[model samples]
Target: MAEDHPRLAEAQREHWQSTYGTHPGMYGAEPSDPAVHAAGVFRTAGATQVLELGAGHGRDALYFARRGFTVRATDFSPAGLEQLRAAARRQGVAARITTTEHDVRTPLPLPDASVDAVFAHMLLCMALSTAEIRSAVAEVRRVLRPGGTFVYTVRHTGDAHYGAGVAHGDDIYEHGGFAVHFFPRHLVDLLAEGWRLDEVHAFEEGALPRRLWRVTQTSPGGLGGS
Candidate 1:
């Protein structure tokens, strides 16, 4: 599926492998704060299993496993998924964490209504077009059980690097060997259907204060929607 789209296919392999190879434990050992908070929220909601898109290096996946949630950790990079598998084994949580090489632009492999929650950290903003994002969100919605939660983080349109790179399409820009599709708040509301938006908040991190939109939503109680 990635091969059909030049940008998506191009962003999937070599560059990311090089980036992961440049440093062992690239994203570090700690889980992102949003992942930590989501775990608590999931626990309160009685959710025990999750499907995480772009689960690079297993940091957040491992964190969720430690919190007793079985997580299906996926990424487009084989290197990233391999790293996650090794980390899961080392942490003795391999049974709780499953790793797969997956591209969010395509349909998810899980069965319908199979997971309690769907998660993605910066995955939605990684070179995916608006149409692709809508398909991805719908796939996430499909795999989640009724009323399941969906949480994803994206680079905000206000980010310092938003327009600093070569323009690709829409809000997409390529810089430093990576392409990111920044999202305005309105775009989320526009593309996101079938699910109710619960929150869309601003949060920044890193030295550059990388602006982010942390969004959370819930599928409708019946057939589920995102």
Candidate 2:
């Protein structure tokens, strides 16, 4: 199934680059609702360092930084990362945040048990195969400190766009040059296997009002330990 979309990842990367280039800070400056909620969760967990995947233009990353959490934000699009860096500088949170060009399909460039909390808004549902998504979660597990918290959101099978657009198999569909892998509920449960699954809240975002699930989980290790 993964093989069917050999070029999907690269194509999506290019499309994102172009999109970000054309629409700087496209998502605007306000922090997302999930980010606001994740910030509280991280604070309650005693987290200081935050790792955010798919942090385009640093809206949530800057919010995390301003909230006193050190942030490392990564995205596959260099253009997006550049915009994030610029925004961080303008917000005077550049010292509190770092940007990296990364693809979630690859191993995260961080040591094991490093960050105290991780956040990803709509990152896990990007044009990735099932195996790739599992591997990405495993990488997240590896990089989280003992008992670290992870808050992420993904478009689910119930989303209106789930089956729309150009089908690329693996539940991934490309619409307006953006590819998304709409997740099934079983896949979410599968990814939460070794972790303490906390919550799966259903919500909507954007004018399309994309339906999504906000998942919160904790590492197997006890909270604030190690």
- Candidate 1: list runs displaced more than 4 Å: 1-8, 222-226
- Model 2 has an lDDT value of 0.93
Give the 10-residue window scoring lowest on summed lDDT in candidate 2: 1-10
lDDT score at residue 197, model 1, on the 0-100 scale: 86
Q: Which number leads on lDDT?
A: 2
What are the per-residue Cα lDDT tens digits for candidate 1 across 4-91?
3475447556788778877667989899988987887677767899899999888999999988999999998887888888988898
Q: Model 2: per-residue lDDT, tens digit, 5-39?
A: 76888888888899999999999999999999999
Clashes in candidate 1: how many? 0
Error of 1 at 41 (Å): 1.6
Give the clashing pairs for model 2: none
Worst 10 residues of 1 by lDDT: 1-10
